[model samples]
Target: MKDKILIAGGYGNVGQVICSYLAEKFPGKIIAAGRNYEKADNFSKTTGGAVLPMKLDVAENHENSSLLDEVLLVVMCLDQKDTRFIEACIRRGIHYIDITASYKLLSDIEAMAGLAEQNGSTAVLSVGIAPGITNILVKHCKQRLGILEEAYINLLLGLGDEHGKAAIEWTVDNINTTFDVVENGNLQKVRSFEDGKESFFSEKLGKRMAYRFDFTDQHVLPRTLNIKTVSTRLCFDSVIFTRFFAILKKLGVLNLLKLKNFRRLFVKVFENFRLGSDIFAVAVDAIGEKEGKRAEYHCSIIGHKEGIITGKVAGLVAEKIYNGAYASGVFHIEQLFEPEEILKELEENIEIRCS
Candidate 1:
């Protein structure tokens, strides 16, 4: 029997695409799980994958049933208020992949490194675009530059993609400001849309501006990789929308914008707004010494929707762990796989430029 792959939020926006991709490739080896069995089953039927439904709830108190015992790999698409889900996976010695951006929860999950190692279990957290691709680029730069001065990361998201409620909710939940990009050990306040703009001469999307925003990887990478200075910025395709949102953020109205009615209006306008394309771009700059001399590597990629790129990368990471292609234990995306192999897998859609 093919190994069973469980996707926690198997019917979500990014989850659907991943399910389709996995179903097409693996066939009859998927378990599309979520709280909503109807949606999960419906999605499974449409994707033509034999999806088994499971409650697998991550509430305050829940038990690890035998249902999860058969699963070899678990893809976490749903976000939990805590780390119960990850704890369950670790205890069961099941390989896990996640797209969560919560640093708090990731930190809690990271504490399980000892348990994961003891169980010979592989777990990959922060496997989305910002954390996934960004982490990969950081590792690549660090390897290239023997003693790097600083690493600057800029992410330009395509706002036009029809993002699902979960992703949108995630965005809204993160709309407030808290994290600061560390440059040379200096903590800089990262107010939303406040980071200065950097233009991206990317394919498909053309030139776009990137702003500094707090993401989970920005916190985890600096400590894990031992890079001195690290900072992350975010930008979208819609200039007008960015400006408007930034102003609202400055006025302290962003919290009010999270209401259901406000979200509806925002989505409605977002739907009508010709503000973005389903294209994205990433730029990584590192300054350091190579061959006993100073050198820098500038790497970039232009691809599809931010979510699609994120989901594809997550899927690839999941496959590696499930197939034993990567080492067991708690690891980041970069530690588990080769940067070149990952870039090769995404070559069909992404255009890479390195200097």
Candidate 2:
């Protein structure tokens, strides 16, 4: 019977956390799958038999792979260059959830909605913190306002928190890049680490300047929420550290990340450096109309250990999809579930305030 949960890249940093959380509730039914069998097996042993290990690589062709024959759901913790494996999963009518923040990859998956529906499969995208919770928060703001004209998403990630190597690489690679964002109902090109905006995170973390960054939530929200303007900015918990990168960007020093060696070294530095508290924050500011008058709404969440929280969110969504029946097609987290439904599940682990 197809009753097992398969977590691709299940032995990695964030993947391990997801495996452990789901293993608690669905013991002996979670499979930690990856290309490295030894690593997968070792991590599984740490779960005390709750999480089983499987040798599975998602990059290869899945046309004849029977590894997923008994799997009912897949929680993707890794990023893929293409959607072939995802298509294979949907064709088999397996439920899928992805925590990736890649807009292009997500768009490809979304294009498969018709196929997914035809095969009776359900897929959830944008299942991580920024795109996951931030997307929902923006939706919350939209609900309060008569019409949401513009929305800004501020993300503060703690440098001291251990981030996965892939995440670190993505950050380092994008520091000197340019991406497009919707501005006034038009696509505008913007460079990363520029156009800094100050956001009030909390009492302990005061106001910090966050610069424009290509978080997928900003791209997904304009369409899903029908908002004209949406932007996502990123900063570290340490103010000095955040400024230092801005300076580097201003001087074109961050462009060195284009070199393979320099990029690897930069990733290494981030991996070894612990410069701030392990506290993460998300604040959303919305501008629109209420009762035909201009209005503003604000909401924020402060938490610790972002990677673990990401796993928890993914696990929560996975549990919902596994046990319940939803429309058989691709949908973003906000499109399928309400903001309150997600925030309530996280109230205990986070401090949430709205205005």
In every candidate, how many clashes are there?
1, 0
Where does model 1 exceed 4 Å of error? 53-56, 60-62, 186-188, 203-207, 251-255, 258-274
The TM-score that candidate 1 achieves is 0.89
Q: After superposition, how far is residue 208 of candidate 2 from its true place, in Å?
A: 1.1
Question: Which numbered prediction scores highest in TM-score against the true structure?
Answer: 2
Best by lDDT: 2
The residue-by-residue lDDT of candidate 1 on 1-355, one tens digit each, is 3278988887777877677667766777878887788887777677555555556565634345776767888898887887776777778778888788877778887889898888767888878788888888888888877776677788877787777666666666677756666667776666655656665545555555666677777777777687778877777767777777777777888777668898677656655664677877788877777889988887787787777777788777777676665566777777776688688899987888777
User: Can you write out model 2's per-residue Cα lDDT over 232-291, one digit (the tens) per residue?
Assistant: 999998888899989999998988888999888988988998878789999998999999
- Give per-model TM-scores: 0.89, 0.98
Per-prediction RMSD in angstroms? Answer: 2.6, 1.0
Stretches of model 2 off by over 4 angstroms after superposition: none
Please give me the total number of clashing residue pairs in predicted model 2: 0
